[model samples]
Target: MLARNLPASQTTEKVVENCPIVMGFDLKYARAGFTVMQSVLETTPDAQFCAFNVLHDGLPDFAQRLGHLLFDGPRSSITFIDVRPHFDHLELFETRHLSRAMYYRLLIPILFRNAQAVIYLDSDMVCRRNIFAMVDALPPGACLGAVRDNISRGDRARGAMMRDVMDHGPEDMLELSLADYKRDVVGLDNPDRYFNSGMVFFRPSEITDSDVQACFDLCHAPRYCPDQDILNTIFGDRTHLLPERWNYVLTFPETVGLIPDDWMRHHREEEEHAAILHWPGPRKPWRDPSVPQAEVFLEMGRRLDERLQEVAPEFFKDVLPAS
Candidate 1:
């Protein structure tokens, strides 16, 4: 579907094939959301796509700004929908306090209405390979698919934090880490199970009508990462991991040997390949002026955010943050 508002000269079409159509959202991550919308608008007018934003409060000014950024592309045919109106199914979790787990509930209703299967991605990510390949690999009755974390960094090194995060002992660290999961999460019967939730494909039919809400309720109980835990609880064995290239988290620019010099070059290369680029840490290229590769991400933010300075001026400010 295309955006509701677009320039008169622009036109777009929907093309469907053997695979299930794909859907994704960029909720709180508005910058990445707009970038994703632009990326999709650039490449895939013929391919079926949908954009979700749960936080839209229906304010005219907010809606107008979002529409201008997302839908007014050169070849625009993108549909941006606000799912806030249909909050009835999971009203127990208000949008304001919506945890990452509860945040996923609105998608189920959208998925149920559109296609049997859909892949949801976090806004911080950039996509390299075609996402259709990832969606094609899921088996029937499965609700999710993803790639394993690219770097394990080894168990012992991650032990201190992982132990505290999972509340497990040294012995259980391996199990908790699922350091072996890439080898065993799917019972060792099917090898494709240890994907990172940063990128995932899900089939709503596989999720019980009540399961989405149940997962949200589970969030208040106990958790390290609410989203991951809810997904692990709900989808479990049905989830599969795709290859890593689909959602490469562009690591801090320093590690790539470019440091000060190659930052922009690497950032450009990543942007070209990525279906989505997941900027996982707090050192956002937009907000951190000190980062060597800050320019590209900063430019990206300028395009995505209507009020870049107001929302995060430190992002565009010439001076770096004080230590």
Candidate 2:
């Protein structure tokens, strides 16, 4: 493994204010998706939040839909931009989803240029905590911060996914593991590292100073999950390991003896303000109905969906019932 030394205290120096410039993006098909995320920000009085989407072209219809959804004045905080000119490479837009790539490639730069610090989240996440406070927790100059992924479980899942999707041979899968797939192949070592890309935060300097570019270059070469792999590689050591309270994934079994039941209920009820709830697996609220957290997630999804439709009727057709 390659290691680089950086200034210890410099990485801990706070550059941005306590508030974070929150961001998330949605592809057009997600259906009023980003709007629900924006609602949390609008309701949050402490943090300065912004939601956006990067379209192939600036579709007027979608813009109108966004306007209606955010008619309550937070529209000023939301943006719909075209990234075609800003990022000319098609390969850069190929992984995960373009909306996600755009979040990193385009928005990260803009954040740096603005001299702001922000946490970039995926649209699938639900905000349950005070986001700004979560950002404030990062040590100053820390290039990135995120919760660690459950590696033992993630490796089994990733292996199965590759076998199911790519028909990879057992040997190929084994080789990937031997090559430190969970580490080098995946961009960082397991246990101490390997975080889900659903949530990440960093200062603008990290991206502006070639760190982001370094991650991008490594990702494009092998064609991996662009966001997670790139982030793991770039902020390997610099990332602050925040408590599970912030970006809690619903994978830990009840037997883990961790999060208290009452707190789980509070987070589910949006009472604790848990920064974000990441349905980090395939069982998304609107798409997968059998998820153990289905009922709670569905209720939230439906209410938000209805709210969006009432305001932006044309843009948000009924979200397809948990396909």
Best by lDDT: 2
List the candidate 1 regions with Cα displacement exceeding 4 Å: 1-14, 17-28, 45-65, 72-102, 105-113, 150-157, 161-194, 252-275, 289-323
lDDT of all predictions, in order shown?
0.46, 0.51
Deviation in Å, model 2, residue 180 alpha carbon: 1.5
lDDT of 1 by residue, 1-323 (tens): 11212222113433434233233343344555555554444344434444433333332445335545456444343344455554445433222323333355435534454456655656554333345545556777666776544333222133323443344233543345433432333223332233456666766667775766656565444343445545665566666655445665555433333222343354345444445455655665555656433444455455445444444446522221211
**Model 2, range 1-323, lDDT digits (tens) per residue?**
10111111222223335333444333443443454454354335432434443333444555445544554353234445555564566355353423334334334655445545656666566654345556568888787778765433434443434433322334554445422455545555553456666677766765554765565565344333556656776777777877665676654443222334554454355423344566654556567656544454455566666666676576455332223
Which candidate has the highest TM-score of all?
Answer: 2
